[model samples]
Target: MSAIQALSRQLYQSKLPWTFEFNFNEPDYIEQYWTHLGGDLTFNRPINMMSLPSHFIHEPLPGASATLATISHQQALQYMSAQHLQQSFLLSVHQYLMQNIQNNIQLEHTAEHFQMSSATLKRKLKKHQTHFQAQLDQSRLHTAIHLYRVHGFKTEQISQYLQINDTTNFRRAFKRWSGLTVQAAQS
Candidate 1:
């Protein structure tokens, strides 16, 4: 909410200054949660609505810099898709795991999602030189990072969301996954 204007100043060109709106209608006590965002961000609107999806409307990137970045990203995607079927499979698995992160994810259940027997899934993963446990860990790590960094989720919230049940174990897992503490990861 606070940093978008500064960040946009560096990378994008637009006709008018950008405005932001958060749709989550919150109360006064919740104001403390946003104070760290900086005092300049006190502007709020539609003070009555319960909730709605937020969107950032921006013009298309105008320069060759955008063109080059887009082309490079597309090339990387094509290369990864053609050369790493295993990664594509693991990516699907990662998405499934993230979607179900708050629940206990089991090998058999993940196999069911892919329309295969558990053994078949294990064998396929083994061929890829990886296994289900590693993917689960990766997904948990990713979800934790996204929650904490992008959504401002606290350790307790992220712990429950990842189904860790215990905060200390979740802390250790986050440290192991990213080599940084949760707060440090934000920077």
Candidate 2:
């Protein structure tokens, strides 16, 4: 479904861990099968939801309407595969940026690292509706958030990690990115 594909794309872009919730009274044979297949199954929850670590592919159960379920499963598979491919492309860009966060990464440098011309890389990113600087800022914002919230890093430490010479600028940027002050985000 388009809805599933959109959610998958969003999850892939965010690169956040999540848990799946299912609404079932008990663990049925079908649930056990999915669990054996490495699916995280949480039953008797208030809602039915799927979590995507990176463009998750939902597998249909065996015990469903043969005709309708088959059609739906095929459609879902197609969407999932397509979304996975798109996410892979974006991941390549983001990974390169994050890995070289300490260095002053430029488009040409990144393109050379990836073995492509800068123009070509730009075109590819354009196709994805993102540019290098945007990705860089997003990666930094996520890292800063994690360091501050998870690792309990102070604002000055986070600013140094992000290569922002001024803690004030980092604070302003964090507020703009998350709509929360540094103290608020930490809390």
Weakest ten-residue segment in model 2 by summed lDDT: 54-63
TM-score of 2: 0.52
After TM-score superposition, the amount by which residue 153's alpha carbon in candidate 1 deviates from its true location, in angstroms, is: 0.7
**Tens digit of per-residue lDDT, candidate 2, span 1-187:** 2355445446455423445555455554765535432355565543355554534345433344689878998998899898874547789888878888777778899989989999998898899998887787777777786676457788999898878889999989877665667776554
For candidate 1, which ten residues in a row score worst on lDDT?
Answer: 43-52
Clashes per candidate (backbone, < 3 Å): 0, 0
lDDT of 1 at 59: 42
> Evaluated with TM-score, which candidate comes out highest?
1
How well does model 1 score by local distance difference test? 0.67
